[model samples]
Target: MSIELLTLCLILSVFLVFVTGLPVAFSLGSVSMLFTIFLWGPHSLQLITHAALGSMTSFMLVAIPLFILMGNILERSGLAETLFKMVYLWMGPVKGGLAIGTVVICTAMAAMVGVIGAGIVTMGVIALPSMLRRGYNKELAMGAIMAGGALGALIPPSVAMILYSSLGKLSIGKMFLGGIIPGLILSFLYMAFIWIKCYLNPSAGPALSSEETVTWRQKFAALRDSILPMALIVLVLGSIFIGAATPTEASAVGAFGAFLTTVFYRKFSWRMLKEACFRTLKLFSMVMWILIGASCFSRFYMAMGAADLVKGLVTGSGINPWLIIIGMQISLIVLGMLMEDYAIIMIAAPIYIPIVTALGFDPLWFGILFIINMQIAVLTPPYGFALFYMKGLSNEITMAQLYRSIIPFVPLQAVGLVLVMIFPKIALWLPGLMFE
Candidate 1:
């Protein structure tokens, strides 16, 4: 069969299997294995082994599990809760104060943890109850938690960016730096959206009553609790941004800092350590397996010359380069609804990256745009991981409520995506300044 026809069949087969409810890793692997054996014989099996080994052994990829472990440890510790409390006190008196505070706390957690689950679950458990008790709207409160937590994917030190850089063969440092401005912008947009919504309808995110206001003394006490936690962020991200440490080294620092925070806060124990390690293993293993499957699938697809087909199809089309880029973004959003972000990246990056580069766009900038779409993906309904994470945390929240909560934030994420696409410098500026 022609490679193009084979590629089409492979795509359909994978999607069909996925529709049958198979796991993403197995869907990608089984299809790739069947095709490789059919096309190239048993000798092609070695490609899968090599891809697994190569993907699992990368030193750069080690940062993923380390950062994950750091986040897990911090999650089990009381540090994130304390950090949220700190922000809650400082912002609690203002309009929509708790939701605004949740964004600040999630942003701070994002800088430290680099994963969404930490912030989402942490705030869901802590802030969600408080917001509900304070008479805030359920959908608005839940929406703020999920949306803010999703920031971890866009912010620096993101595991999503790490995987993207590893697959794209781009600079991990540059990708991390590139995400900063856009991350801050999206965060600001989320906070601004909350303020506007609450301002228009005061019932949605009501400010604390005079009786519930925190005293200045309490605020100072909360600030004191926050100083050390803030220092850890500075120690880790600051080290990377200032060229004092590599990403891998910075991950080590983050993990160690998390450990110290647990111990310093008297939240440490053998059980906590054990739980953190076990959770880390679970999360890290899932990510690695996905990576292995994607690597193998991409290998076989390339061996079948599908990448060239995609390049030819896109480049040969009479479409403008800008339209092609827009089309690619739209496809990502569609695929994102049904697939995990990493799986989508694995399947699409190889095909799209070359097309993007051929169109004269910077890969690092495109990487940031892809990450922003991922931010949207995890908040989109049906299969959004962030939505599930929030619902899992609170029995009070139903799936329908969770879906309704994230609706407004979805468009806000798209706004951020479009801004970065149009003004590449929003992503590139910080990277250029820091790396130069």
Candidate 2:
């Protein structure tokens, strides 16, 4: 069969299986196995074992479970509540202050945890009720929490970055550093959007009533509670930045520090520890399976000459490389609506990274762009993971409302992606300064 026919069949089969509602990992693995048997006979099925083993033994992947454990512990540790209280005390008096504070706390939590679900669910539970009770616009309140929480995907110590870097053979430390500015810029844009929206329509996000306002002493007390998490964020990311530890070693530090945090907060218990460990295991297992399945699928697809075919097509077409890059981003956004970010990374990274590098663009910059697009993906409609996460937080929110809530923020994310694309320096400068 022609390479194009093989590629078409592979993609269609995966989508057909996905429509049957099997898990992504199983769908990918099953399709790849069938294809291997058909094209190269059953003997070639041994390649699947090798791909699974390779994914299992990757040293960098060790960071994933550790990071997830840290995030789970911190989620139950009352750290997010304390950080929200601190932000509320300081920003609650201003128009749209609560929403703005949600974004800020999300940014801080992103630094501390570096996982999207933890931030979204924690803030949705902690901040959403407060915003509604204060009469904040439903869309504004929901959008803020979702957009801000997604920051975990871009901020330092991100699990997605770790996975992408591991797959692409990029520097994990440089990827972490590269994300800092873009994450902050996106955070800032979210806050600015809230402020401006409330400014134009004061009733949309009114300031806290006089009875709910706190004194300076209480505000300062709330501020004190944030110091520990801030310090932990510093210790983890700082260790990686200064070469004191690799990302894996830093993840261990983060997990330990997160334990100490719960102890210091008096929230630690054997139950909490067991729960965190169990949750970590489940999340890690899901990631590993997807990695293994994707590894096999990509390995077979490449063996069919898909990568070379794609490279030849793009290079031979004579299209502006920038336009091709934009087209790739658009296709990824469409994929995001239908697929999980992990699946997208697994399937697309191998094909896309080589093409971008061959075009003389830095793969590191493209990786950041890819992640930002995934961040937007989680907020998109129909099948967005963030939308589903938000829905699970409360039954009062319909899927339609959840979809509308993200309309404003998705554009903001797209704008952020474009900014990084236009000025590569935004993503590249920090990594260059630190790693070069």
Candidate 3:
């Protein structure tokens, strides 16, 4: 069969499997296996084996479970509750303060946990009720939590970034650095939108009543409780920036530090430890299986001259490279609506990275942009992970409300993406400054 026909068949086969509602890992693996056996007489199965083995043995992948363990431990440790208390004590007097504080706490949680599920659910359980009780608009309250929680995809120690950097053969430390600025930019945008909306329409988010406010002394006490968690963030990201540790080593430090936080808070229990480990194992196993399957699928596709075919089409076309880049971003957003962020990275990075480099774009910059797009994806309707997470938070929150909540922040995320795209320095400066 011609490469074009084969490529079309491959795409359709994957789509059909996805429609069948099979797990992503199995879908990719089964499709790749059937194609190999049919096209190459089963002899090519060794290639898939090697690819899966390589993914399993990767040293960088060690960080995934450790970071996950850290996040899980911290999630159960009451740190998010402490941070939310801190934000509430200080910001409650201002209009939209609770919603803005939700964003701030989510950003801090993103630094500590580097995953969205914990942040979204934790904040939803903690901050959402407070905002709603204080008469904050439901859409605004839900949007802030969803958007802020999505920052986990763009912030340091992000498992998504780790996987993207590993698959793209880029520096993990640099990719981590690349995300910091863009993540903060989006956080600021979310907070700004909340403040302005509440400022214009005070009914959307009213200042906390004086009776409900805390004393300045209580506010300071809450700040004291936050110090240890902030220190942990500094330790993890600072070590990477100063070259004191590889990303893997920093992950170890993070995991230990997370345990220490639990100890300090007296939240540690043998049962808590067991639960954290179990959660880590389950999440890491899911990620690794996807990695193995994607490795197999990517290997087969590349072996079939997929790279040359993509390069020829992209380079031979008279389209502007910038337009091509925009097209790729749009495609990623659409894919995000369908696939898990990890699977999208695994499948798309192999095909897109080469084209990005050939077009004279920095892969690191493009990787950060891809992550920002995912930030939007997780909050988008129908299949957005964050949207579902919000719905699962309470039976009262309908899917329709979750969808409407994210409408404003999705565009804010896009603005952040566009800024980074127009000025690569937004994503590249820190990485370049530190490494160069």
Candidate 4:
């Protein structure tokens, strides 16, 4: 058979395996291995081994485990809780105060820990109970946590951006910096939606009593708690942007900083260290497995010339590259509604990235757009992991209620995505300044 037919069959086989509900890494790796051996002979296994070793040994990927460990340690140390309490006192008592605090806390957590799970679970436990107790609308309360937590993936030091940079072969520095502005924009979008929604319907998000509001004196004191955390984030991120350290080295710095922060707070303990390390190992293992599978699958597909196929088809179809880019975004949306963001990134990104670059696109700009799409994807119906995550934390929230709460936020995520799409500078400018 021709390479084209082999590529087609390989892709179809992967989809079939996915549909069969095999674990994502297994699905990709097994499908690729099956095709490689049966069709191309046993020697094809060497390709799988090479791909696995190359992917696993990546220096950039080392940052993944370190950053993940940092996030876990931060969450386990009670520092995130202290940070939230600080923000809560300052921001609470306004309209939708707790919801707003969730955004602030999630952003702060994003700076410290780059994983969505950290933000999601931390806020789900800490912020969710407070919002519910304050008589906030269930959906709004849940939406705030879910929406804000997803920001971790876009913000600097973001493990999602780490993987995105890895797959897209873009600058990890620029990608991290590029995500900072947009991450803040996404956070503000959540905050704006909170303000507008609560303003229109006061009953949905009730304001706290004047008694709950912090006096100026108390606010000033609370600022001390935030100062150290904010400084650490700035110090870590700044070092990477200013060329003081590579992303992996910065990850090392971040982990050490988080440790010191925890110790400085007197929250560090053997128990916390053990728990953090365990969690990091688990998270790291999951992503590494996925990476291995994606490596093997991409290798197999490329061997069959699928990348060239996609490039040729898109170009020869006589479609404008801009329109094709739009089409790619739409496909992501549809798949986002169905698949986990990790699965989408691992499986589809390999195919899509080559087509994007071949069309004269900047992968950095496209990475931001892709991250924005993932922010929206977390809110999409039927299978969005963020929605499910929030639901698990909230006993009173129904699926329908959770879905409705995200309705407005979804459009806002799309607006952010479109913003990146149009203004490449939102992603490219900061990185450009940094490199130049």
lDDT leaderboard ranking: 3, 2, 1, 4
- When 1 and 4 are scored with TM-score, the better candidate is 1
Candidate 1: deviation at residue 236, Å? 0.9
Best-performing candidate as measured by TM-score: 3
lDDT of 1 at 329: 93
lDDT score for residue 211 of model 4: 64
User: Where's the lowest-lDDT run of ten residues in candidate 4?
Assistant: 206-215
Per-model TM-score, in order, reads 0.97, 0.98, 0.99, 0.97
Write model 3 residue lDDT over 57-166, tens digit each, in one string.
99999999999899999988778899999999999999999999999999999998878888999999999999998889999999999999999999988999999999
Please give the CA lDDT of all the candidate structures. 0.88, 0.92, 0.92, 0.85
> Model 2, residue 83: what's the lDDT?
92
Tens digit of lDDT per residue, candidate 2, span 278-305? 8888888888999999999888888888
**How many residue pairs in model 1 have overlapping backbones?**
0
What lDDT would candidate 1 get against the real structure? 0.88
lDDT of 1 by residue, 86-122 (tens): 8888988888989999998899889877888888988
